[model samples]
Target: MRAADPALDSLQGLALGDAFGDRWFSVPIDELSDALAVRTLRPAPWPWTDDTAMALVLVRHLITWGEVRQDALAGDFAAEYGREYHRDYGPAMHRVLRGIGSGGDWRAITSSQFEGHGSYGNGAAMRVAPLGAWFADDLDETVRQAELQALTTHFHPEAVAGAVAVALAAALAVRTRGRRAPGRAELLTEIAGRLPDSEVRSGLRIAARMPDRTSVRHAAAVLGSGLLISAPDTVPFALWSAAGHLDSLPEAIWHTVAGGGDTDTTCAIAAGVVAARTGLADVPPAWLAAREELPDWVAEVSTSS
Candidate 1:
């Protein structure tokens, strides 16, 4: 039998974590608080949101083409969003995908979002981890591919930075396989070296300085966790959680959830990175079973590849 693809493993971890984290969105504040206090998860059949949807599209494209071809990726993203319109896409993303589906120029549509300032949202970062693992042998290539992919829907520097950061984290995780997990300082140094000057980079630097024993609430207070849905607000905390919990996939995801902002995306990013190192063996069977199956095309590609 063929060995499982590491990239596919990362994607499964990402999608499952995305779905698992999403379950918290519907819980009452009191109930959520109680669950968190005990580190308990919500019920099963956890449905994923746009984070998994978009990541699957990217994974499918990679399996078919071996690299991100910008034009084809744009089309695939549009087609995926159009088919899965109920996945809670953000308004800005909806506009971009709709335009792309209608044959509008992807570059123009992406650059024109948010009144021409483009988007600084976490959308780009949410779906990019597998790309990192795919190019893990080449950190430079991972950053380049991550930027190209992010530019399809997000043109803002911060958004691109967030994508690059997550990609680097995943690549680093893959690189650390069978070795000791990277320390926070090592991970941050590598990521910061690749990232350009941006709020996301600054936030990651802050994350590096955060003590290991810091509580999630304290960490979240110092580093925002997507409460504003911006790259700067999310990537730092997600990376911090992933680095701290590289040995425990469930704990990494739980830390992301405990941070309490844009839970699904944060957990998705964190889980993807840690899973590159730990795979799904450490993830709870119940959580994996609860996630919706990945897109059929993604499964077909993985099987046939």
Candidate 2:
């Protein structure tokens, strides 16, 4: 595979996982438990949500510029959100992106989120894995670019920390591919070291000590799965899922979905990191076939050398 393949592969995995996880929401509330346990939910043409939509924008921007250019990235994000308005974007994000589309200042609109506390949402982390894969050789650059990308729409320290953690996880997956898989402690510790002191960082510290055999329920209870849709609630568990199932994209995504909250975003985050190393080689053909096609622009980029 080419050096660029990891980023493309991560994008594919993220999108597929996002789409697959979204299908769970369609299941009846009563059947949800059985569906999750038996893995019997088979919804066709699984459409991805805002996770993949924003991720596509980020991937295309990086491919075109060879690095993140914040203003351009923000513009692309706003444009993509406008073009795909039906992709279930959160209300605050919808408002922010719409504001940007109308010629408002992205910095002002983004920083003004949540009464000026800024958004601590996992939106930042959901779209950043491919950036990490693209800059896999430089951990410092990966973290730097992740923060810059997060700042395009998310300004909270916790949100930026979530992006940094996910990006580093992807980068580490790429960096450690074909080597003995890094242990859970090693993965969490390395990611924690790159993060600032915050609740997100504190979560990683806790995650580092979590055993590999810990159940998804227990892990979710401890680390969260974006149940509250905050970065501090999401990034650690997704990373923990990715760390535990580094060599298995399906298993990583399954564990992510089983954890329940914000399933699409969590699965996207975990799948992207896992696929940075494993790629789509082991992904179920049926699942990949069911995912909606990526945007034409990104499809062209993926097929290129």
Candidate 3:
């Protein structure tokens, strides 16, 4: 219970962005296009998906342990997944979580994914911002904790890199909260420098070079927008959006969703990272009202030590 405020802000932004982006999938293609052009507001009670679901578990894990204990984190993930399996989890995750719930070892369950190549999914990246916020004062520890949490399910190096990048982004956001963060190039350069050699790192480097005036469609096409449900396809553009809109959670999300691929996860990643810096300060009332409420357990834990 040490300064849960920023972490809670990140969680709220994550869940809100998840719900907001998920809502776009329900509209007709023509309507969606028109809506995007005008930035139409969606109806109330926007529901979140597995992105928010998994993030809740992550925040709760951080609340309970204040650091990653992989075995315990795995158990909690399985238990949560067992209770709710309809949150739009990918096929690989279903198998891994089911196996873990059946008392299988976390390593064995995760290692079995993709015929032992393991998963490179964005699930890890999408849910890690609060952890970064939690350990903002110690970025090395943030990377360590982020990797440990990611290895519970997403075992690929790309996925680990994705989590590391996102966590470091959030930590940096916290470190610079309430102030002007570094410029886009400097911010992305710093993030990319911390990552291991991987597609995620390469993408961040490319993002660093891209001009800020670039259109969202062009940017998403270049950096990718989670089309593959993989970390490399998602993290960079999400981070780019975050770097540009660190002062506004809703703006970061709008830019993310405009990319039009795996929006819930992308928005979740971007909003979580942005909110780690901006908190809920710039969230519009309508956006806040449209998002579904977080689980009561999250509130309970936020209030607890």
Candidate 4:
């Protein structure tokens, strides 16, 4: 189990998860509609969705700044986002970005969301795996930087919790790649210690108890899937998938998408963390070919960084 380059591994994982999860929408109706019943992927080109796009934004920020600069990242997010205009942007996030586009203060826009609690959406969790991989050698710093990045728009506790879980998961995966991968107990303990008290933490505690469920179908039932799309609901499913399939990026992502809720994000989180440790060697070549092409800036940033 030789470790791969963290950046390359993380990038591939994020891309694969994004592309695989995007199958629900990009695939033919017959294929997607039948995926749940079959529990098998059709041989098709995977086209990633918003999850990959936002992730590229974060990777670009890290490559350019070396650390997350709140203002700069926020501006980059606003610019890169809203381009599709039809992608599934959360209502609160959409409002925040719209405000930024209209010359409103980023802080003001974020602060005004969710009745001043700010957004607790899984948006932060969706894109944070790369940050964790970037700081894998330093778990504490991984949590710190994840917080700095998440606060750009997601100021709520659950959002922060979700980001923390993803960051710590990425760090654990990278740190343990060459050795035995962390088991569910160790993984959860590390993440729980880094995170403060929250429902997300509680859900993780629950996830650690169900490691052998070995199926996203069962895990999501216990973990609430991502239909709620909050940190508690979404993060647990990702953690469960990551823990159960720690060494297999494709299987982890498959489990996530199989959960049937917030497929892109759950898969993104699972892919990002697992891939950081396992690398792209395990990803199907066809899936990579099918994914949306990375932006030139995103590529330049990851490579240069």
Candidate 5:
């Protein structure tokens, strides 16, 4: 039973965050802090990066299959990368995607990353919010689908845990929208309780305990804002920021950006979760106009194979 297309809303939010965050990378080192301090908005043509690109592929996959079909997903990931390798994908991905695109077994190729430890990179978590929204009504299935999709590229337990956490956050955000927002501590606990015991889960637990009034800089320093580009170093802070600003789309992105490291992915995670609840209803028209247009193929995409 399909419902309203909140996942599309999540995708848009993810893209906006991706593009907005990417712009910060261009700022002069000294100017970056001043820019962030002023809350100045990036101008038009905010082109998104790999986070949005991979997310689009995931959304298209869900529209075609309604759930993860791992082999096909692995192929789709490769195909998408093949078409557009300029989306600022992480270096590891270029290697991984090239291997998969060359007809190598995805499991073998992916499991072989990071010297056979597999990748615990934040890539799995960065692009999974829409999938979470897609199965928002049933959290068990949300975790199930999230894990499957993540396994296509990131085979490490921590990476899988990161994906599950973000997906759960997006699901809860959508489920609670237009209703009383859940307690931040309570919400983070619920998400943490559902995931395996890993640093990501541990960080989420810590995020649950932090005072909501904490500064983004402090929170990022503690929970991390993707500085390491690994799940343990990222997802906790993204979820924390999202939990704190579920009601405001723009503020959530801004706050997430203040954390600095891996700004694009952190902002993407937080924005996607917040927008799953708030939609673009509260987002300024100017901000929307500034974001580069989403792919044309996204409009009215039918949820059928």
Candidate 6:
């Protein structure tokens, strides 16, 4: 059953999904690498990666301030990333975050990363659900705030699109709190219409057409399973999993994990979308208990205000 309170549902979904994804990291490197190729998951007690941690940072800001404060958000992300450096963060992100932790100019450090390419990673998308859930009554508000949240780390159009799509999807899901989830086509169309045309949107458009017909392997091949690590490669598969199993949070996470690639992120994204409609019920009790306890600040941020 979906929660009457949108915020808790969003947070729980995001957190559980993130935890599911991080489990990949604990496997022996050879096994983990092999699993990536075969589209398999080792199962739970998954230690969340950068996705959930950064998400917690955003949730804290929203719960405390009720709006995005880019610098503060950035500061919190950098600090958290530094403290938890072993999380599955990207190389570029690790460098930029470390620089920020050392008091370097965030803009200079992040922009200087990836040979000046900046990040086009799905990091922005992984943690944006609370913004969407909190502003479900206003799509424009969700989009606007999502942009603000993304700007702190991801500046590329594709990166922004990933964040926007996640936020939009979450917003739509939240609206389904007391009703049946929208049809797959309707869900995809609503998300695409609200999001500007981009690689992410195009992928989502393709995903909207899939409707659980494709095998997880085929979907990963077509939409990518996060192996490429870019928004275009990651977002589509995640959205497909979400759309295919919109009413079943566990199913969405399972599909995402089965797709392999970036299992954690895909699981996280799917969790966010599915949870919006189904609430925390989608999360398994054992899975929730097994996840590493979030930091005091993270828990506080989610509960603040």
Residue 183 lDDT, candidate 1, scale 0-100: 91
Clashing pairs in 2: none
lDDT of 2 by residue, 119-150 (tens): 99999999899999999999999989999999
Better of 1 and 4 by TM-score: 1
Span of 10 residues, lowest total lDDT, candidate 2: 25-34
Model 1: weakest 10-residue lDDT segment is 1-10
lDDT tens digits by residue: candidate 4, 1-305: 11224855686688788777766634553555477666676457667766777777887677667788999988888887768645677787788877887777888788778788888889888888888888888878889999998888787888998998998898888888788887877788678777889988988888887747456667778887678878788998887788777888877877677777777778888999889888878777767777777768655544554
lDDT of 5 by residue, 1-305 (tens): 24537898899899988888887754554576688789888767788899999999999898888889999999999999999899998989999999999999999999999889999999999999999999999999999999999999999999999999999999999999789888889889999999988999999999999986888888889988887899999999998988888889999998888888898899899998888888888888887888888887776552421
Please estimate how well model 6 matches the true structure, expressed as its whole-model Cα lDDT.
0.78
**Taking the tens digit of each residue's C-alpha lDDT, what string does model 1 give over 137-217?**
898999999999999999999999999999999989988888899898679877987899999989888888877789888
**TM-score of predicted structure 4:** 0.90
lDDT of each: 0.88, 0.89, 0.89, 0.79, 0.89, 0.78
Assess the local accuracy of residue 48 in candidate 6 as a C-alpha lDDT between 0 and 100.
74
Model 4, stretches more than 4 Å misplaced?
1-5, 25-39, 297-305
TM-score of each: 0.95, 0.96, 0.96, 0.90, 0.96, 0.88
How many clashes show up per model?
A: 0, 0, 0, 0, 0, 1
Candidate 5 residue pairs in backbone clash:
none
Q: Which stretches of candidate 3 lie above 4 Å from their native place?
A: 26-31, 301-305
Candidate 6 vs. true structure, TM-score: 0.88
TM-score of 3: 0.96
Cα displacement (angstroms), candidate 2, residue 143, comes to: 0.8
